[model samples]
Target: MRGTEPPVTPDGRYIVVRGRLWRKANPALDAEARQTLVADLMKARRAVRDAVRIRDDMSLRQARRSVNDAKVALGERGPVWWTDGAPDLNRRLARNTIYAEWYAALPEQP
Candidate 1:
């Protein structure tokens, strides 16, 4: 996600990663809010890793839930943040969704 520039849709709704679409955080969110959510998401992800390493089912579940909550709050999951009613293409292959034409035009893709 760092070495090469990830291609984000023109609408700014999703970023293509490994040929799959992942929802972007809500652009409407203020910088501080977005930063805080991102921080929480990272912490939760670390917790998930630790739980898995320790073989703690309860902690794993809690960590996963926290991660989900942070993602939703960041507008990366749950309800669509946009008002246009476009169906979510998250986790879908870029070649199979409405972004196919755009993705095909890219100079490089996964």
Candidate 2:
């Protein structure tokens, strides 16, 4: 993601929005920061109970911050991540469905 351009669809319809393609002004730092923030958001979501019980304003704010961090990082790359890797990564991710299944089956550690 740091050095590679993103792919575009053959029909130029869709692009891979996530993974290593996303970048920012400072791509390396921003990408890692975004990953950290997303991971934190996931942690917060998992820590909560039912929907009604998850209403912690502070944590919600933190999730917003994480979203902003990721958004800012993506902006820094100036669309390079989206436009460049669409074809190759999209096919790769689609074909690698089994990897996703395996990943989803992994146990989460608290």
Candidate 3:
């Protein structure tokens, strides 16, 4: 995966790059809440790895759900953290939009 950190929109609600949009992390989350979510995410990730190693389908499915839930809580997936109705663009990569020039200026990912 590319490591480039996309530029945030003027309002700071979204990161736009290559004409795609990504919701920023929830700024309203308290430090404790963020920490707890991170812990849950890490635990789920470990569970996934262990399940794969053991070739356990049930465990893997449960672990994947947990991972998704954790990500949603962390504002990394699911609904947009912002309430403004800006469409959710969690995973998009295309061209021709307001931010195209900015995206073009970004250094290419290796």
Candidate 4:
């Protein structure tokens, strides 16, 4: 899993990894909504962990869906937040994109 707090671009609108851009969470999300979604996300994550420990495949599948739903609600998935038409690269491996060289050259985040 990626860190809960990913590094944001200097402008705070995008996540910056190896100089590549990924749209950040929706700024339009109000505080209460954000909190609720985050809580749901955490709950789902805990469910996933529990399911894994118990080796319950059905529970794991359901928990994974919940996690994805929460992420979508939180604007971490789905449509691009920016109007520039940049491809959504959330959860993508750096080596798969055009910025692979740049990503490889940059030092790992501390």
Give the top-scoring candidate (lDDT). Answer: 1
- Tell me the TM-score of model 2: 0.28
Between the candidate structures 1 and 2, which one is better when assessed by TM-score?
Answer: 1
Best by TM-score: 1
Model 2: per-residue Cα lDDT over 1-110, one tens digit each: 36654443334333333422222233344667767755754554554333326787666666555555554444432243444464323224422443354333534312
| lDDT on C-alpha atoms for all candidate structures | 0.94, 0.43, 0.78, 0.75
Kindly list the per-residue Cα lDDT of model 3 for residues 6-110, writing each as its tens digit: 677666766765557776668899999999998999999999999999999999999999999998998978777788887765656534545556567766734
lDDT of 4 at 11: 44
Off by over 4 Å in 3: 1-22, 94-98
Alpha-carbon lDDT of model 2: 0.43
* Cα RMSD for predicted model 2: 11.2
TM-score of 4: 0.69
User: Which ranges of candidate 2 are over 4 A from the true structure?
Assistant: 1-53, 76-110
Instruction: Kindly give the stretch of ten consecutive residues in candidate 3 with the minimal lDDT sum.
Output: 91-100
Which candidate order results from sorting by lDDT in descending order? 1, 3, 4, 2
Which regions of candidate 4 fall more than 4 Å away from where they truly are?
1-6, 16-23, 92-108
